[model samples]
Target chain A: MVDVVKFSGEKEKFNPNKILKTLKRAGASREQSRRILKDVESSLKDGITTKEILDRVFSGLRETPGIAAKYDLKRALMALGPGGYTFEKYFAEVLKHYGYEVKINQLIKGKRIMQEVDVVAKKDSTYMVECKYYNYPGNYASTKEAMYTYARFLDTNSRMHNFDFPWLATNTKCSWSAIEYSKGVGLKITSWKYPAKESLQRLVEAKKLYPVTVLKTASKFVKQRLLDSGIIMINTLMEMDISELRRKANLSESELKKAILEARQISV
Target chain B: MVDVVKFSGEKEKFNPNKILKTLKRAGASREQSRRILKDVESSLKDGITTKEILDRVFSGLRETPGIAAKYDLKRALMALGPGGYTFEKYFAEVLKHYGYEVKINQLIKGKRIMQEVDVVAKKDSTYMVECKYYNYPGNYASTKEAMYTYARFLDTNSRMHNFDFPWLATNTKCSWSAIEYSKGVGLKITSWKYPAKESLQRLVEAKKLYPVTVLKTASKFVKQRLLDSGIIMINTLMEMDISELRRKANLSESELKKAILEARQISV
Candidate 1:
């Protein structure tokens, strides 16, 4: 059993490096620390946000007894400012992974702006997009303004350079009024839901776009099978006529019972 | 000169616990880290959030630069999640320093049901506020929905509780239609602006709230004279009357000239 009193750091002892270093000094191998740090750095390079890093660190620490003190970790993390930028950046990277050309720290018109626009795929001359990770339950007045500004900017800049369509994406369902407003103002709005289990299975069908390695192995089969069964169930329910099956089986009521017994006997 | 290259501790070689132990080793005295840790524990006698601990660590680190980069501080910090109770808790504390009571992880209703209100502050019985920190141009619609939800929440909650006023707050300024829409829905919207230098000077006048402290020593007459002059300047500005000085001096143009000449002669 871990010594709670000996292992517990102070309330503010959640410093990641400090905790890692302390563990190393207490007989944990330097190589192990290096391994964790490499994972962290790779996560960062893969565009994991600072907040996610904190989460991952805490998660890893929780796995080892006496490795993480409840209070100390929080204290160490509180030292950093609320890491909004890190979260936003990582969310953008996730979108970009799906064949989207991501633009960070972009400006529309003369106003400077930073928003995670998911996919900026060129559909013919127009940029078709699916926006994800949008803050849910907010008014689109500013989004409209951003669209108007972007549209105006695109019209001038793109025409001069001869570029085409610009698309807008959103995570939460768009507002009817906002959609109408965008239409009235000649701005295009597109929707893209998160990759749910069902969708993930569908996406995996075209495995070239997203390798199976990207998903967890154990749970992956479960979701895929569920999706497969759902489709089969729906198709049979909708298109397969029971009367046709009966006709194909060529069985009357008494004959059906005899046939079922024979079929069971054959299997036995 | 600051050695930027010397600061590079390859992430592949990072050990978080080593960093903690190093701070214990390099702090002002052998007991300094212990004392700070004790202070953190005492401060967190009540339940303390992860962010509060981080803030303390950063504060302690800021005061001691020798051990700053020794920890590979940045990488360790990335372990936290992006936005959740942790980030909201930190954001609330910062806002609280400026006199706000904020809530985190709550749903709001406006045109529709919206979840995830970052920060909500109450100024008075009548004022309800929502705070948002977005690095990029946010989807205004969602924010508007958040603000609307906040408004609606307050509208219902305030009426039920019989609160007098309600208002919404945001870091990003609301668009014209959002503001108008809010008005239509009877929601008062407000934006918080950080105090300017001039505002701080004005704050000095509220000396009862912020008392001046003496650092070393100054002559009594000099102190009295400085205070009197400051008061005079304030009064004069308040009344917007420089002419009052002429009356107080009781000097005509000729008399003032004669006095200046007499002073000059005495000096000579």
Candidate 2:
């Protein structure tokens, strides 16, 4: 047993089970999860911050090719932020893969107000979604955001002849008040791991809509350039020829081939 | 101008114009409003509490038959609580007057949860309402209540094939966060003098569904008995024959007659 210090300055006995479980949730096999936990446990010392342990695990996973793809996913998702627009586009692609016709940044006129809907999806029913992207992991979508989205729905729905479903989708978990408010207003919500069966992770895994930020071989500058040119999804890059990718992403031939190979290898 | 102390213990110069505006909003004529203000101004003393001013206004209005009906309205609405169930029934009656088919204390099953709705009204559209009744005038319906109500709406609507409007109607004002949150969730809200044209006072005055507690002639005990018997609205009481009113409300013959006559006079 090792004493670990949390971000809040509290000390508690560290449990290796927590790390093992997290590794498994990220798609590691049982053997790989146990191996990762053993490595983390061997490096643990008294007063080590939880952040340091996570950094160690992340760096250690890079040496293991088989499990690195799964482990890099959470880190890649976190890196997509501080800029919410990229996440929204990425989210739109995920929804599109689920068979919904999606339009981003749409303006609709409601009875009493004009609303800017982040994404409008249509299948049998029209859905107006407010995409909340947080730069940091711990930040939550608040009740205030949920309330405002609902009001916009009311305004827009009053003017429409057809019924519209209001949804609040965030990159991170919503606050307790936000979740409660969303449920009360008939607003569907999808957060990172909330709603269990239909969370962002579930959708990502089901649709295989992995973002380019997850490719460990790509440099931050190359990733940013590709993201800027709207090449967000790994599938999108994989579909493109290496020459086209080099031209669009402003990458060297060698870097482009490596990125494309990494995207192809991990996505499968 | 007289200086008055607020409930929060802040002293400010009292303006008679503020009183006049409040009277007018409650449906008092200009002449009657000015007369009431003059009486309040003359009686005012330095460092008087805001509650004391309201008390003086209420007492002074009781003497004037022409203006009393309008001024007692705010007070009567405030008296509806300590018991929220009674208020829900009273609110149902008000909805009924607006041509809605109303049900009180209904159980509805949502996709994820079952909800006990305070009142449900159906007309062209269905409305699920949560009634918040506060016993005292100074108390406000809070953000926590709004959040919970929204969650219930979400759960219930998930199972429903038809569209339903979720509304929160309170006899008192809602807190700032509550109001903000209600808007976000698309939850319709009706509170005392809130949202200007769609407030509870506006709805009551439009339909003339004044509750029995609004009658200055009825004592607290008698009012409670009438409410307990489900004789909530003035219109409902006015429709009842004197003998039935006495039997159902357990009021003395004279008290019944006086109450019935007051209901009849004020309703017109």
Q: What does candidate 2's lDDT look like per residue over B1-268, in tens digits? A: 6689975477899988778877775556787677777878888888888888888777766655434665667678878776788888888888887888988888776554355788888998888888989876567787656765765576567545243778888988887867776776677888887878978888988777788887778789999899888898888887888788888988899887777777766766
Q: Residue A53 CA error for candidate 1 (Å)?
A: 24
Per TM-score, the best of the predicted structures is: 2
- For model 1, the superposed segments whose C-alpha errors exceed 4 Å read A1-118, A124-201, A212-268, B1-108, B114-128, B132-268
Model 2, position B241, has a per-residue lDDT of 82
lDDT of 2 by residue, A1-268 (tens): 6799875477889988778877776667788777777888878898888888888787767755435655556567767866678887888899999998999988776553355678888888888888888765456787656765675566567646244788888877787766766676688889887778999888986766788888777789888888988899888988988778877877798887887887766666
> Worst lDDT window (10 residues) for model 2 chain B?
B154-163
Residue A58 accuracy (lDDT) in model 1: 51
Q: List model 1 lDDT by residue over A173-255, tens digit each.
A: 44454444454334455432223332322222222222111121113343233223321111222233445534543334443
